[model samples]
Target: MLRVADIFGRFPQLETEQLILRKMRKDDARDLYEYASDPDVSRHTLWNAHRSLLDSQRFLEAVIEQYKSKEVTNWGIEHKADRKFIGTCGFVYWNPDHRRAEIGYALSKSYWNQGIMSEAAHAVMQFGFKKMLLNRLEARCNVENIGSERVMQKIGMTYEGTIREQLLIRGKFEDVKLYSILRSEVSLEC
Candidate 1:
């Protein structure tokens, strides 16, 4: 059973000096299509390119439902300077017993190399450590995803290790490089 209250409780609106990180909406289908449907953005991720606008709509509906279910905390990233929706980023899987969670994100190609992900990550980490009381946060990137690895470094996370053939993405095992930032390691300015 899913409750709207629970879903609303999962994702809280967050603001950084340059961006607005907030919950997704039904009307965000156009924004969703920008990155979620792009092959370049989805290539490294586990999921494949969205097949159609209808598919993106369906996916957004399910994500919104999950928001209501408290199953995931997903955010729509918006740049304040431009007041435009650029992409999505948020905590994916939360593991309370382990005091950690997996962080995932995808940015439209237009936003790449602009330090947007790093800024969003800092805001998300603050939410995890302070509001969620999480002790650890992890970001696992495909071995070849140097740009993603750079975001982890920009956020002050430490390289954990590479897990060989850890994920079966698109039917082939792929190596994943894990990075983590602990509450103890986080700077107050973060």
Candidate 2:
């Protein structure tokens, strides 16, 4: 079994060929708002389109606070070329007793289809299984989110099943498709 203390004792930073996954800072609010405010970007997510910079700032503040606890871990995705915040990914739910976690991510529409999310998620999967000593890492996306489903598949997660009306997003109950990978299924080469 994984111990929360052992995993949260040190902050983890993940890197890919095109992106850096690190903790979000207050300074990233502007960049985060630029994309988070896009309705297209927020369409499939639970969060509504950000109306102003303050909205993004508030979100960042909450993410910052989560980092102070052992309950969650989030990383701001930074483009290596420009070092701009393009999105965020992290474990939204964790259970050390069960040795499992549920991951989530969002990317700027401008950066979509570039495989950045796949790379970032791949690294995160490694961290979850190896460093965190998690047996299972799972992800879920709205049934209509083909992009997110593709990312989950690219990361070697197997599609589990869709739960009907499993989530109430934007006041509507939405069906969510689940995917998961076990530590035994992933090579601990990270």
Candidate 3:
């Protein structure tokens, strides 16, 4: 069992062939705003599309504080080729006693369907199992989000069924599909 501090003490930086999963910084505001402001990108997410760069900046400020406080926070997804912050991926919550955690992510629409998110998520799952010592890693997405569901499947998570009105997103309750994979079920090649 690991504590949040044990994992977030020094924000971990993960890398893949096409991405650098690192801490979100104040300087990433512009890049974050680029994608976060897109209605299409945020349509299925809990948060509304960012209205301005300030919205992105405010979000990063909170993430920075979370890092300082040794709390849970997201890894900024930086596309290696463009060196731009394209999205975020990380644990939404962790229950060490159960060795379980829920993962979440959001990506720029421009890079959708490119397998970039699947690659990034696979790395995060590997970290959860290998470093975080998680027995089970889970994720949920709005029922209508086929893209997110595909990412979960690509990373080898099994569909676990839908929860009706699981979340109140932007004033309306939305159903979500749950998915999970145990450490024992993971394939490194994923």
lDDT of each: 0.84, 0.89, 0.93
lDDT of 2 by residue, 33-112 (tens): 99999999999998899999999999999988877775576789999998899999888888988888999999999999
Ranking by TM-score, best first? 3, 2, 1
Best by TM-score: 3
Query: How well does candidate 1 match the true structure in TM-score terms?
Result: 0.91
Candidate number of the best lDDT: 3
In model 2, pairs of residues that clash are: none
TM-score of each: 0.91, 0.95, 0.97
Give the poorly placed runs of model 2, Cα more than 4 Å off. none
Off by over 4 Å in 3: 188-190
What lDDT would candidate 2 get against the real structure?
Answer: 0.89
Candidate 3 root-mean-square deviation in Å = 1.4
Return the clash pairs for model 3, or none.
Answer: none
- The regions of model 1 sitting more than 4 angstroms off are 1-10
Candidate 3 or 1, higher lDDT = 3
- Candidate 1 lDDT score at position 4: 28
Better of 2 and 3 by lDDT: 3
